[model samples]
Structures are given as C-alpha cells and as structure tokens.
Target: MAKRRRRYQNRHGNRNKTKYIVIGIVGLVIMITTLALTLLVKNQKITLKAPWTLEKSTRIKTPEETLRTYFSYIETKEYDKMYELINEESKQSVTSEDFIARNQKIYEGIEASNVQIQITQVDDSSELGAAISYDMTLQTAAGEISFPNQAVLTTTKEGNYQYLIAWEDALIFPNLTKTDRVKVSISQPERGAILDRNGNLLAGKGVASSVGIVPGKLNEDPTQDLNQLAELLKVSVESIEKKLSAKWVKDDSFVPIKTISKLTELEQTTRYTSDETLEKRARNDALLSIPGVMISDTQVRSYPLGKAASHLTGYIQQVTAEDLEKHPNEGYLETSVIGRSGMEALYEKELKGINGCEISIVNEEGKTKLVLASLATQDGKDIQLTIDASLQQALYESFAEDKSSSVAMNPYTGEVLALVSTPSFDSNDFVFGMSQELWDSLNEDERMPLYNRFRQKLVPGSSFKPIIAAVGLETGDINPEEDYGNAGLSWQKDASWGNYKVTTLHETSPANLENAIINSDNIYFAKTALKIGSEKLQSELDQLGFNTDIPFEIGLSKSQYANEGDISTEILLADSGYGQGQILVNPVHLAALYSGFANDGNVIKPYLLYQKQVQPQIWLANAFQMENANLIKSAMEQVVSSEHGTGHAAYREDIVLAGKTGTAEIKASKEDKSGTELGWFGIFTSDKEVDKPILLMNMVEDVKERGGSGYVVRKDKEILDQYFGTQQ
Candidate 1:
C-alpha cells in the first residue's frame, strides 16, 4: 500500500502542477478543433480543397434506396439531381449540362407521357457496384413503347448508398448511344376521290394555277400591275397586297394570293358566258404579263360539274386544332385535310387515308441503327355514288334564276339519279381556302345560296293527295267510282267549331278518289283523311316513313305528320290530309314514297352507294294495297294525259307520263292571301315497258304569283324532255 501511494504521489508531482495541466488542455483543444473541421467538410457545411478535402457520408442508405431516389428525380424532372446521381466515369463522359439538355429535348420532342418504371431485379453482391433490372413504359405520339432495361450502379467513395448510376445513353433508351439520333418520319396519304355512277370525277385531284407575287421582284410602284392582276383573278387589290406583306413573307418567297381552276375543255361551260364558260380566258395572258405576278401549277381539289355538283360533293378544309385533340392518334397532322359537309363528311373514314409513321434510331453515318416502330402508308378509298351526271346537270339547269330543289330516281330500282339544289356556290372555293368577304356574302344573301334544300322538309300541299287517296282506297274508305268530292269550289266537313273551310282551285262534279287525285281536289282528300281517322291516318303515314329518319347515306331532316307526332284535332287531321297543316316532308323521302306507286305498294329504300346491279330494298312493305297503289298510279297518268289534268302540260305524245301537282300556301291563316306558295310537281313514267323509268320530284319557292303549280309543271316538262331525249 505504501508503494502504491508513493507511485501515485510521484506521478502527480511529476505533472508540475499548472505547467503540465496547461499542456494537456492545449492538446485536448487542438484535437477537438480538428475533429469539428473534419465533420464540417464531410457534411458540406464547409468546403475544403486539396489536402484538406474530406469525403461525405452516404445520404442514401442502400442500393435499393439509391435506385428509388434516382428514378424519383427523373419522374420529377429534377435534371440536375439526375446528373448528380451518376458515377464519376459517367460524369466524365457526359457533362451535367449536356445530359440534362439531351434528355429534355428527346422527351419533349416525342410528346412523351404516362411514364412508368418498375424495378424487376437487383444484384448488389459485387463489391465493385450494384445492378438493377427494370421494366419501363411510356406513351408517344405514334404509340406506346415498353422495354426491359438494366442500370449499373458503380461503387462510390462517399454516401450511405455506397453506389452511383454508371450512366450511358443506353440507360436513357434501349439500344440508344451518345452519337445516335432519334427520328420520326411521317408520310402523308393521298385523299380519296368521289365518283359518279359512270366513274366521272365529282371531287378529285387536278392541276390548277396558283397565282402569287415576289415582293422584291415587284416594280417600285406596283399598284397598277396589282390592280390589273386582281381584275383578271377576280380578287381585290388590297387582298393581293395583304398576302404580299404577310408576316412570313420574305423577299424570295412566293406569297400565294389565289387558286384558279384550270378552264379545261372537260369542265362544264359556265353561265354568264356563251354556253357557260367558267371565266373569260382572254385576261389570263394579261394576268401573267404583270410585274412580280407569277403563276405556278399546283394540284388541288377539282370540281368538274362546278355548281351543278357542288352541293352534292361538299368540300374539305385544313384540319383544325380542335379536330386534332378530339381525334388524337388518328394519324392526323398539321398538313391534313378534313371533310366538312355533304357526302364528304358522311363518309370521312372512307376518304381520309391512313398516314405512315416511322420511329427509328440513326447512327452518326445516318444509317438506321434500329427501327422502333414503322407503319406503311395507306391511300384513301374511292367512293362511288349512284348518280347520273347528265341528269344532275339537266335538273340543275332547269331552275335557272329560281330557288328550287329536285330529286330524280329510278322508280322501280330505287336508284337516285340526281339531286339538285339551285343557287349553289363553287365547292372548289372552299377547298382553295375561302375568303372572309366571300363567306360573308354567302351567309348574308337573302336567297340563302348555302341552303341544302334537298335535306329539308317542306309542305307537300296537293302533292300529298295521292298518298291520302291510297290510304282511303286501302282502308275501304272510298271507291274509285264513288264520288266523295262535291260540285263546289269549297266545302266544310261539318261546322268544325270554326269558320275554316277546305277550298279547291278548280271545282268539278262527281269528285271521286281518282278524279280528286287528278284535279288535286282538296276537300275530297280532306274528307278521305277524316274517314281514315286520326289514329289510322298517323299509322298509315308512319308506315310510309313519316316521323322517322330515312335510311340513307346522307343525313336529312325526318318527315313529320304532326308537330309532335299526334294529330289531336279533326280540323288538324283534315288540314293534314291536303298537306297544309303540321305535315312536312323531305323531298327525298317524299320521292321515295311516290316510288311505291310504281313498285306495287312497296316503298323502296333509296341508296346512294353505287352498285353494279341494283336489288330493290324494301323500306315499308304493304304501304298500300296493290290495287289501290295501281289506282293512284292510273290517276296520276290520266292527270298528265287528260285535257282537264293539272299536269297536262307535262304530257308527251311519244311516251306515257304520270304526275301530280301541289301548291302549298304559307299563310298565317286560312283567309290570308299575302303568302308565298311552294309549288311541287312529282312526275314519273307510267309506261308498260318500265325500263329505266325516271321518277322526278321538284319544288320551287315563291311560286304564288309566278303561275302557281303551272310554273313548276312547265319546268318539270322541260327537264323531263331533256332527260328522256338523252335516254333515247
């Protein structure tokens, strides 16, 4: 014990009190300061360079955690963070700035979306690094892409993850390299053609002259030259100037002003000319001689029949942004065109061909490294319609300076021969890009040149008598010899609780069903409808295609027997019998119903798609009894053949003709005289031969003072004469 005490005292004494204590304190303080500096540098709280630099501890705990963090940064588009997660060798190969820009361009260019990454496997046994296998999927403009990939994580000097991404271009996309290029090549498809029954072009591609001007090549004062050019092109000088000074116009650019259809010999001679030449060709040379005015041949949508077939073919316009959004992945581009109206719109799928798409990787030598996706180009289909171009033109020209709608068909075959709407505009103008002023004029015109009247429902007036006559005969309401029409210009079915009276233009005695139909006796048919009763009347009309849309390729307003499908009053039902009440009929549908007379009471459904051999399709069977339909057909034939017949003007000595006439009064009341009349004339051949017989129905507006139904009858005769003459 004494030796231990002595040793301890000696050790304490050797310290020399304050001197040894001061030395120990200074050493302890130096050690603590060194430890703090090392920690600060390691945590990045303080930056030290060269000999004093310290490696940071791993912030990411495990290889799996590191993988999640790396991918999470990518999902969040933290580009700088993504670059930082790579290993030293990868960083040396691709700088942080290059890596970020490269990824951003590729992703945005492809319109990448719906990114999803799933880790499939991970291997961290190697002391050198860790490896992760994953599946990735992303959507692109062309299609969806999915691939399996692997990411190698090299061992890092610092951080808890102990590994970093060994980055390469292949990590961004499967089989991609730094020197490779991603390309998307799109091939445009040619639009389809619209052809007539005989393979005539209704809407197709043809060469036209595109007129433009190069600003730098113009004279110092180009007003006079531009004025002359405008006059020849039928455009305003201001429009030419505006196009020349467009925002994208350059000194060498050819700023287009107008596209003029080539006045080829094949085109129908236009109106306002000797025999309707499109335009005066004498000015074309003068237009070309003007300074800076240049004409180039360009392909455009051609309209051969011009105004004759414009309403049937419709037009196409540039694809709108809204269309692109609504039809994403439909293979549409900015350069695409879309059908806007008429048969073009109804058969858009058959007209808009599929475009080609190619997504591939190209190497430095511009050789394809890999074809990611490829689709072959598909051209649009040619749509053929059952229309006779000659008949269409003849029908259109029949309504010169008149507002009219006409439909011609083969009564037995139900093949529509022609559909004509007068006061029409050139559809080619729309395809060439319509001017705002021209468009305004069409909309603001009181005549309504843009109106598609064939698709509209109009009052049939006396033309509806044949249908009522059929109804009466089929239901045993009236006999052909029994007289229902009285000898008076007007008659009333009872008092009807009002002063309304059924009036006829011509009074005849013994106005039986056949005679009533021939003279269009309003009271006789009115009484017949009352005898049929409202419920039965509606049912008959329904069977005849009222209140239902016609099964056709193009959309037309449905025919209606009443405003809301019910004839609630006797007066209403009586008025409807003469086609004057709430009854309205589409020209096409009415024509189809009239076809039943020639088809033995079977209403044949009309079709527009061309077929080599036509087989009649029944729309309504037993619409009328065979004898009743034949009786109506016989009366219509007499109406044209007999001297007292309203359609006597349409009579021809060489061929048998049948017809019915209607004059619809658009009046506020029964006594109103200051109203326009819609004249209707339905004519067809009743010959026993029955080969290629044509049934034509035409309607003319504002015919009240212009000769009533006679005006329509005369026009119908002229059209029929020409059509039949051609057939002969």
Candidate 2:
C-alpha cells in the first residue's frame, strides 16, 4: 500500500507538468498568428520574410517624376494639374487662376508651337529635396526660342505624393521675374517712293482734301447736302453717316467723310473735259456752300502722274490673310500694304523694307523693364525709273481718245523714254477706293483699257518689212538690186497652192527687194521666204533674240515664230516672212529689235531703271551689217522726205523723220475679208543728235477705212511735232 501511494504521487506530478506545457504551446501559437496578421495588414504584402528582396512601394512619386509630370501637364495645357504638382509654399506664390491666365496669354500671344522639354539631369542627393536640370524649346512668333533651366523640388506631405515643384516665374522662361512682363514691339518702316528720271513723283506722298462735317457746324436738315456730298465724293451716304457717327467724333470734331484727290495740272486739261472740270470745281464750291463742310488737307499716297503713268507705277492695297499665308516667314503684318500690280508688285521685296522687332519686358504703363533682344529697322529703297514723266504724259495726251499703244526709246542710249497705253485709269482713284460705278465702267469699256497693251504681242504688219528685208540681205538670199519678175500686187507659188495666193496693197514694177519693201508688197516677201526657206529665216530671227525671253525689268511674253516654234508648211513659212501666220512680236521685243536700225546695226536691250548715267547696253551686237541697216534707213528717210513715197504724210522739213508703215490683216483664211487691220508705224530720227534722237514705234487697232497705216502716220506726226517743238 506504501509503494502504490508513491507511484500515484509521481504520476500526478508528471500530469501536472504536461498540462503546463500544453497551455504554453497554445499561447505561443496565438501570439505568432497575431504578429503575422498585423504585419500583413500593415504592409499589404508578404514582406516580413525577405524585406530587402521586395520591390519598393509605388505609392509616392519621386522628385524627378514630379518635375516631368508638371511639364507634361503644361504641354497638355492642364494648368490645374501643373499647379497641383507644386508644393504648398509654391502655391502661395501664385493663385490657380492667375497662373492659368498668365500662361495662356503668353503662349497664345507669341503663337507658341511645337513645345518640347527634356530632363537633362537630376541631382537626387538628399531625401528632403532635389535639384532637377532641364532644357526646353518653344517656337514663338518672333522665332524658335531655346533655353536651359533648373527646377527645385522638395518632399511634400500631400496625400499620395512624395515630392512637388517649388513654383516660380523663372520656370516659365529663363531669367523671367515676377514683376517683369514679356512683350513684343514691332517698328514699321516707311514705304519707298516711286520717282521718274526727272525726280517727278510717280507714286509718293501727297495731300488730299478731307471732306468732313462738324456735327455742331452742320446745316439744319442736312439730308440734301449729305446726298450731294456723297455724289460728289463718289461714296455712299451710309459710309458718310458711319464716319459722322464714329464714337470718338465730337460736335466740333472734323468727322472726315471722304478723301478727294486734288487734280494735278496735267489732269485739269486731259483727265476730264472742260465741263467736267468745271463740274468738279463746282462741287467743291457747292461743298463750301453747305455749312459745316470743312475741307482739311491730309497726307496720303499720291499719284502725281495720275492716269498717264498708272501702268508704270502700279498701286498698293492692304495686306491680306492669303498673302500672308502664301509668303510665310517673310516679314509681313496685318497693318502693312502689299503691291498689287506693275513695278510695285515686281519689286515688292525692295520696296517693303525689313521690319524692326524688339523682344522685351515691360510694365503695365508701357515702361520698359528689360530688353531681351532687338532688331534695327531698315527703310525701303527709293526707286528711280528710266521713264520721262513729261514725255509719258505728252504721248498719252496725244492719243488719249484712241485705242493706241506707243514705245519711245533712245536708240543711241538704249533708254526707254516712254510707254503709253491710252484710255487709262487714275491710280489715285484706287488709293481713295474706287466706287462701284467707276469700277464697272472700267471693266465694261469695249477698248479693254485695263489690258496692258505695251506688254502685249501684236501683228507687226508692214512695219516688220524692214526686218525681213535685212534678214534677206544677211543670208544672201536676195540682193537689194536683184530684180525678180514683177507680179504686181498678188501672186501664188504654183498649182499646188490651190486658191491660196499672197496679196499686197500697192502695185509696183521690177519686183526687187527695195521696190517691194518701198511699196510693202506682200507677194515679194512671200517669194523671198520661199527662197530663204524656213530654217534660214528662223535661224536669223533666233539670233535677233526671237524665241527667247525679253530681259526687261517686268516680265514679258516671249515673241514666237510659229505655234511653239513650228512652221509646218511652206504656206505658213511664207506667211511668217510677211509678219503673218503665227508670227507674233511683243511690242517691247519689237522695239528692242528696231534698236539695231538706228544704232548702226547694234540692237540694244531696252531698260527702265534709271542709273547715275545712261549706259547703252548691247543686246544683239551687229544683228545685221551696218550697210544693210543703212540701206533700209536711207529708203525710210525718202519714204517720209519724198512726195511719191508711201509715208509722205509724215514728211518733216527740219526734223528729217525716217520710218516704214505697216498694216497687218488679222484673218482666219485667205478668203476671209472682214478681218480687222492693225496699223503700225515704226520711225526714228535720222539726224545724229545723241540727246534728242528717238526710235519711236506706235500702233493703232483699226485703220481699214481710216486710210490704213496713214491714220497711224498722222497721229505719230502730231506727237513728234509736239515732241520736237515743231507743232504745225
């Protein structure tokens, strides 16, 4: 019984020990589970086992990322996002609205485009802050701008963000400040003047009478006076009313109605009839008759030569959106004027001058804070032309009523003295803004007054005879003395010609080169072409600058031989010899060709730009033998000096004029009889006076019933008589 008691006590102790161990094991398991769960809830990942091997958290962005994102928002025009990417301290520097508005204004004003930014380098040396280096480029209106900049970033306590930018105006542009405002100042240079050889103002500054009405000085019941004023100024009543009702106009202010160009001395006699001039004067008197009608003189672009030199001087109009688009990066502005036609359009670059610009910082009161960059202004170059204004006016006046065109050149000096196309428009009217009625009249005119006849190619007619005769002599095709059987006015090649025959105006015997040319016998030259053939004649014409571009200040249509330089048949070749059958010559080119005759066989290129001194420029040196040119000139002299000659009407006693007359027929076929005639007279002074010598060529559209070339001869005579101071 004692042994049993001791074993039971030992068993009980062992059992107690096991119980304590079990309790301790269960408690240890619970503690470990709680620790694992707490770690999982805190980190949201199994990072407790290998914390160093795990990927870093992506919750907060780095300082470099914050800077890149801020610039990215700028590119997207998300200003609010950019503002949010900045720290609290930076936000205090500018309000959200102020930042957005400032950025928008600057970007839009400079027409910024193609924005680019690069994170050049990032010095992430400290945990609390970073210095990010960046480079940016912006294409602005002035030009492409590029700069390097630094943006400082700092650690932020803002939710879900680790870093933010320290905002400042310097981030917008290099060296930009809070008080400094970016500005672009443009300085417009003055437009150049167009002057003639004698310093006459062809297109330059002038004064116009500003017809305005003072509201206080206006007559009671101003309806009738306003209507009359509108009629006289060729403006609408509504336009006048609009000017009078301008916001800035006061009761005593001269509310300008319209500008009326004052008539020049030449315009008084030629631009209008006596009655019309009196009516214009009467309108001014009538304006004075109305109360409050004050005429104040104001400066404007003046055309002193008026209608006579309109084509030579051209005109100007306001710059358009299309013009600006077509010519990009070419210093153009909305307030500028562009050349519309003629010399003005041809030399736009030289006349417009370079505009000056300044990129600067300015205050609200326009006070300069800083000048970033500047460009000096360059004024336009003054252009002087070879045109003689007095001569141009006189020539235009002589044929003012006719559909005529004339070119007066100095053969000795190669100076184009005058270019006149009659029935012209006043360039001043364009400056003052042409009325609808006037514009319509100009367009509807049957004569095509707007057409540039001087630049046009016309049928040379008999005026081309001298050139053909010279070419014949040059190729040894015919001797000036050789007699080919006389056919008397009309002839044909052979039976192969069918009914087609060559016709002429005059009948003469012994169909030699001189007699044929003296009488302008078409059959004789047609025969001469058959003898010379197409190749030889074409070769000589090419040597004389045919089928080549005329090197004039203004562009000219090339003189052609045939349709694209093709003489398909003998008939066409024959027609070409007599200045017919697709043989078209530009008036300017023909004038240049004629220079050889008066210049001792040396054809000179016509020039319009006046230099310090007139330099004779040789175009076709020795186009023909000096002897051949003289022979033609000798016959031409007799044509005007002799009574029995064809051009006897132009016989001058003292001046000794020499020339050939031409009458070209425009026809579809040989059978067509109703075709119109182009009468021409090419003449030059025989006496060797270097300063006074002239090679003048004039043409009239129709002369069939008006005595053919004789009609042109009479007008030329009248003009020469006036030119040489021998009006008889």
Candidate 3:
C-alpha cells in the first residue's frame, strides 16, 4: 500500500509543476505585448493612447525632412545647427575648423544681401542616402550669377531615426573638391560711338597703353618701383600709392597707374625708326625693366575734333562712390566710366551696354580647373546727330577766339546747320582728367569757355524790327505802302514824358515801311506801337513764345518780353517796340522767330537727332497771314537789296540776301552813366533748290564802337559765302 501511495504523490507533483510553467509562460507573453504596443504608439506607428489624453506626438522625421531642416539652417546662417547635422565619421575625417574654413573661403567678401540659396527637391532613390537639388544666386559688384547644384545626405539610427549630411567638399557645390574653389571674371562691353550727320566719327574708342602693377609678382619693394614709374610718367608718387590702395586692389590685382594715348607724348626720349616701333619698345621697357610695372592695351574715349565740338560732345569720367550710392543695384563698379555732360550724358543708357561674365572652378593652387559658364558682352548702340561736321568746323574757325555765339538753321525744318559757341575747351583733357592748374585756369578765365552761349540770353536790339513790322501789318495799324516817316531822330509821348525821347539810327525824318525796315528806324516802330497799344503788343509777344521756356533737349533759360509787373507807359511801350526794356532773347529763340517769317509765318521746332526721319513741328502754325508774311519778307529783302540799306554790307546782287542789324547799349550797372554796346545781325535767303530758307544770327558781346553792327553784317556775309560757295 505504501508503494502505491508514493506513486500517486509523484504523479500529482508532476501535474503541479506543468501548471506553474504554463502560468509563467502566459505572464511573460502579456508583458512582452504591452511593451511592444507602447513603443509603436510612441513612434506614431499606432494610435493606442488613452481617450482622455490631450498630448499629441509625432514620429522621427524622414530623410527629406532632415534635408529641409539642414538647408533651413544654412539659409539662416545657423552654422552651429548645420555642423551638428554632419555625420560623426565625416566630422572625424574633417575637423569643424577645416569645414568652417572651406565654407568661409567659398563665400569670402560676399554680402548677405547679395546672396540667395534655394532647395528645389530631394531625390531619395537610395535607402542609405538622398540627393538634394538646389539653385544659388549671387549679386556681385561685377554682375549677377545663377547656378544649379546638388548635395548628398545619409541616414543614421538614433532613438528612432535621424539623418546626417554625407560630408564631402562636393556637398557645398557640385563637383567641388577640397582642392577646388570658385572664381569670377568680368568682361566689359564696348561703349557706343558718337557720329555726325554724315556718319563722321566724333567720339569713339581708341587704343591706349596702360601702366599697371601686379603687387604679388613684384621682384622688389613696390615703393621703389612706384617712385621710378611716377618720375618717368610725370606723376606724383603719392598718386601711385593712392591708386594701389583702392578697395579692389589686392596682392594679385593689376592696378593701373596711368594711361598714355601717344608714345611721342611721353617725357622719355628713345630713338626709333617709326612710331609703331617706338611704342613697342616703350611698352617692352615699361614691362621688362620696371620691377612691378606691367604694360597693357586699354580702351580710351577719343574726341576726333577736340575743342571744335567740346561743348556739344562733352566728356566721360570715372564713376565715383557717390554715383554708386545714388544708383544702388545698377551693377556699377569702381572701374566704371560715365558720361558727365552734353549728348554723352543725355544718351548714357543707350551708350552703355550690358556687361558679361565668366565663372570658373579653380584649384587650390589658383589654376583654372574648368570653365563652369560664360556669357559674351553686348556692344552699345551708335548715335547719329544732325550736326554737319564740316560746317561746324567752319563756324568754329570763323569765330577766331572771339567771345561770340551764332546759330544757322533751315527755316522750313528747323534743322540746325551750324551752332557755334566760341572760346571752347578741349574735351580730351576732361576725359583723361584735367590737371588742377588747368581746371583753375579755365574756371577763372573771364571769357567763360564752359558757358554755352547759344543758350544764353541777350538783348535783341533792332534785330527784332521784322517781328514788329509783321505785327503792324497783321494788326492793320499801318499800311505797308504808306509813308509813316521816321517822324524824327527822337520822339516822346506828349510833355508828360518830356526828356524821355526814344532816338533812332536814322539821319532822315520821313520814312516809309520799306525804308523804315531798311534804315532800322526805331522812331517809326515806336510810334507804330502807340497806335497798336501796349496791351496788344504784350499779347502779340505772348503769342510769339515770350514768357515761356524753350522746349529743348538741353536746359534753357526762359526768354522775357517784360518785367513781371511792368508798367506799360508810353515811354516803356516805345522802348518795347525798338527791342529794349526787358526784351531778352537767345540765339535759338531768335532763329525760330526769324524762321517763322521765312516759312510763311510757321515756326518750326529745332531738333538735333537725324537717325530717323523727323517731321517738322510747328510752334505756331499761322503766326501771321500769308500776305503779311510776304510783306515783311519783301521789306527785309529791300534792307539788303536797297542801296541805302543799313545792312548794305550783307548785300549780294546774285544771291538776293535779306537781313537786319542792331547795336544795343548794355548798362554796366543800374547807376552807370554810360554803357557798352552789343553787336547783332540776322540774315536769310530763299533759294529755289533748297526746300527752306537758310537763316543765320550772330551776337558779339561788348562791341567797342557804336558801328559794331556793321562789323557783324560783314561777318554774316563771310559765313554765307562759305556756306553757299561764294555767291556771284
């Protein structure tokens, strides 16, 4: 019985052991499942959180997100965050110091405002890494630059998952290695050429020799070499040093010291067979003998006619810091040259073309590895003007150093044939930089060489007689055929204006309309003004463009007919009729007025551009009736054709010239008892072959003799003879 009981107990014990093992297995399974579910929920792979829980969570970012964050840090210049994302292995290979140095070198001297970067897309084709495509834009002083690039990023395992930028020199820029760098090279465009009416070159580009220095390549101290060069070039040593100290100048930069147009103009003398040989030898000597000097061929602005067209063509000067500030983002550099005045300034944009550039990848040794991209520069457009070069030269020579101004125009079209302002300057001096002494001399000269006399105002004197005659005929105040008579050498308005008599140049008392114009009788026109009344005279002047600014390309001072609140008394009205008392005019204005009479009372707008066909603009379509215009023309013709005409000096039997002359007294001061006279003359001729009559006006300041008008009349004949080829 004992044996049987022991067997039963052993069997029970065995059963109990099996039950405990199963319970332990179930408990282990429950714990394992709960931990797995908690991990899944934390990673956002599953939503198993309690319903009452308010907190939200997210999974580890993908490779694309990692790359986006990295680029965001780069854009904001958060270098620390960017560095933290670099792979540990890459950090070990390249220290943070080395990485930062490489980046700084790539972006050296670039302003943050001038740089822009964009991440376009991430190509995650591989499980271990992804490729990032981006576009980078940089605005440099030279120009704008844009390029496409790429970077590589690799993944790593952390608490969940994260990414690390696969570090390589190429990651910064595609195909850029540790030993490679980027370089920018500039190519300047050729400036535009200025041409005359006949396609004659006025201002254009010419070759010049520029002496420069490569500071890094110098064999000796720059100070000694620069001193020797300065002595040879006749420049100050301090000037050379200052040029070398420019912001753009560097150890590897080519700093230009001076430029010379002609080899013969150099101070040093070296015998050679020809000019070409001499220039070659000089260039060689400058490059080889000087320790730091380098000779190069450069472009310069050339004025072919020099002083003859200085005032018209003006000059170009180097761009200043002020110019860059005023015109930000205009792509202007320190090396830029800009037009300072005249047509050059007016057409600067047209004359300055688009610049181009070359981007290259250079090695650590500064050797060009590859040409990344290139763009060719575009040349500026050429400008053609209406001025006849030969005619301009003739007019300039005719002045012969006299302080005078003149204008010759076609009446029907208002095409200015010759515009001359004497005592001109050499534009080339301004181009290369005029010396201080020379500039002071020019500025201090009493003749005012820089002043544009063609735009200046002067008293019209009796040259305005024809316009008054037109007013009389148009107003019906006087009959052209009737004899109004000179009245006398002097006349006054009753006794109230006693001792205020207006005198004339006439020696006779009785004068007809034709004779009054021929004699330029001031008394007759003064009396005629009284008949028409002062109010009508003012209205007539207003209709004739007085008290208005001349609409010209260049600035012009407004011409005046009367003071702002002038009293129109009999004495004042008398003076007004004779072209005195606040009656001021410019050559251009007078030319336009005279042109009206020649064009059947239509005033044409003057223009200087001839590249296209320009239609004539009529300032006044009908300034007077056709009969009245014809009557004035006939009377003016008699002023030259008539034997006793005051403008007899301008008489030409074969050409049939018509003109008027005046000698205006300009008071030295308001209190001065005596004053100097200004000479004036105007002439025109109608030729059948020419579509419009050619009109000319001359003005000479401070004429010594009261008979100065006669001198001007002779000059008018000479100019006409030269223009029309010696009329028989």
How do all models score by TM-score? 0.80, 0.78, 0.73
Give the runs in model 1 whose Cα sits over 4 Å from its true position: 1-123, 132-150, 154-166, 172-175, 220-253, 263-283, 363-371, 496-498, 687-689, 726-728
**TM-score of the candidate numbered 1?**
0.80
Cα RMSD to the true fold for all candidates: 13.0, 14.2, 14.2
Q: How many angstroms is residue 200 displaced in model 1 relative to the true structure, after the best TM-score fit?
A: 0.5
Off by over 4 Å in 2: 1-167, 170-183, 213-229, 237-255, 263-274, 285-294, 358-360, 653-657, 668-673, 686-689, 726-728
Positional deviation of residue 620's Cα in model 1 after best superposition, in angstroms: 0.9
Candidate 3, run of 10 with poorest lDDT:
45-54
Candidate 2 vs 3: which has more TM-score:
2
Residue range 1-728, candidate 1, lDDT tens digits? 99999999998887788788899999999999977854443233111111111236426645655655665554456678777778888888888889999877766556566666666677778988888787777677556777888888878766445678888888768899889978888898888999999998988898887888888888998878888887777678887877877799998898888887666644434434553343436555677788777878899878778788888888888899999998887778888988888878878888899877777889999999888767688889999999999889888887846888999988877889999898898888886667778899999989888998999999999998898888877778677888764658877777754787878887767777777877788888888888899998888788777877799887899999888759998888889889989989999998998988987888888889999988889888888888888889999999999999999998888788888999999989878779899999999887638556899999999997899989999988888778767422
Scored against the true structure, residue 348 in model 3 reaches a CA lDDT of: 84
TM-score for candidate 3, residues paired by index: 0.73
Q: State how far residue 16 of model 3 sits from its true place (Å).
A: 61
Rate residue 171 of model 1 by lDDT.
78
How would you encode candidate 2's per-residue C-alpha lDDT over 491-590 as one tens digit per residue?
7889798888888877767777767767778888888888888899888988987888888887777888887656879988888778888888888888
Which stretches of model 3 miss by more than 4 angstroms? 1-179, 206-237, 240-299, 365-373, 475-478, 507-510, 563-570, 612-614, 668-674, 691-693
Candidates, ranked, lDDT = 1, 2, 3
